[model samples]
Target: MADERATTVAGNDAEDLSFALSCLAAGAITPEELKGWIQLALEQSRELPARVFELFAPGLANALVPGWRGLIGTWPGTSLSAAEGRAVAGIAHARFPELQPGGAGAPDRAAASAALRESPAIRDRFARVFPSIRVPDEGEAGVGCADAAESGAGAEPDPAPIWWLAGAEDSPLAPANAQRIFDDRRTAGDLTTMLESDAGSTLVLVTNRARVMIMLTGLGGESGHATDPLADGLSGGFLLDNGQEDEYRDRDTVALPRALAVIDHILTHSAPPAQGWSVEVEG
Candidate 1:
């Protein structure tokens, strides 16, 4: 059953790639635009995409070199659009002209992967062989424009047991807490300390978008509770509630587009005390 799940994930990833690529080939977005969406999707989906990509990464490596590596980086701290990300998917098509969604390849997949890994010269040759793809010099091609701050302080945030909230409204997690977060946003090293400190506190990290990340831990370890209630309510979409139950839904979901909208609103409505956080905007 686990294997089945893995197979399904891989197929879905291919479909996702196909869709992303089709969007790119249609000229709907520039490479820069695609990078942002790809970044978001990868974070939200976690390791799912990479597992699926194994089905075709070798074939696509020639055309996807720079883009694949760049896309990997965006998942953590950058934004990438789906359309632009299709360039990475197109790499597979470039490598194996006969390969397509639901297509068959070599009899022993592991052997092929082993062969590729064993030969550095063959790998280098493969990259150079594809002239039409235009692999750019690392220094020349750039990522996207948006600049995002690192998630935690150079250290860490006070991870002591506490309450956490989602959204940037004037709820329990209000301007004061927001200010605290902003104050601590100076360096990642500081933030790391906070996350590791408290075993029983609730930590809320808000994105410029309305989305939020919540961490719950306890002295004994961590609280494992029913998150389905919150997920069901928020999954289909629910009103922003300060209700006690809404306090911790275990894990929650916030769509990127909506999250961005929330972030924009926050930026427009309130300015972080300039003294607290370091600001960097990428052009």
Candidate 2:
């Protein structure tokens, strides 16, 4: 079963790579654009995309060199669009010309839904890591915190936990802040301590316009001011920061779920070791 899951993940990666390549070939995306996607994939699982390519498609792996290195640095831009999603699927189909047809070229909504059906491993891992947030599906309406508050007028409201790093000052987890978090060992250690101290606390980080709620399960005992803390046991998603208005006009609906999946993957597969800490999304 483990082997089967590995194979399935590899196949899914191939589809993703093929889709990326297809998008590149179709002139719908540039290499830089593809790199952004690869970066997001890496954040989800350090071993992936590269590992998938190295194991199954070594030739393509070599092709993605230095540009793929970008994944190690800072967070890139937003998630792909529905049209881009279709292009990714299309490219996957094109790569494996021998695969069955009809489901290859277009983005299948069912596939997205199926992917959301959490696997037992993912569910168990999430349960162990931290409390889970019930995020609304894309395009759902009136589910924001304000709406929830209004609806529960007569009852004691059950608000979700909102954790933030001290001195974060409600700043968005933009590229600059992410870089700082990655670079400052003192800050990283402090954050790690905070995460370790609170099991249910969700550390809120922000991108330029999105809010990333991260939950950390463990921060290994290594004491030195290392460069990247929270290396493992980090998973997050983009959701409306509760009570904050939609501040960014150009919002990408897909970013949060994608970020969440990446965090979950890191927690499940690359948990921090007991003696030494490891950072998953350093670059």
Steric collisions counted per model: 46, 14
Give the per-residue lDDT of model 2 (tens digit) for 1-283. 0111111113333444443444444333334334434544544554554433332232433344343434323122324555444433333232222223243554443343233332333223222221121223222221222233344643443332332344553643432233335225223332221221222433333332222323343333122111122222322332333533233221112233233333332222222212112234533
Give each model a TM-score: 0.23, 0.26
Off by over 4 Å in 2: 1-15, 21-164, 170-172, 179-183, 186-201, 204-283
lDDT tens digits by residue: candidate 1, 163-186:
233332224333233334533552
Residues forming the 10-long window of minimal summed lDDT in candidate 1: 140-149
Looking at model 2, residue 191 earns an lDDT score of 22
**lDDT of candidate 2?**
0.32
Worst 10 residues of 2 by lDDT: 1-10
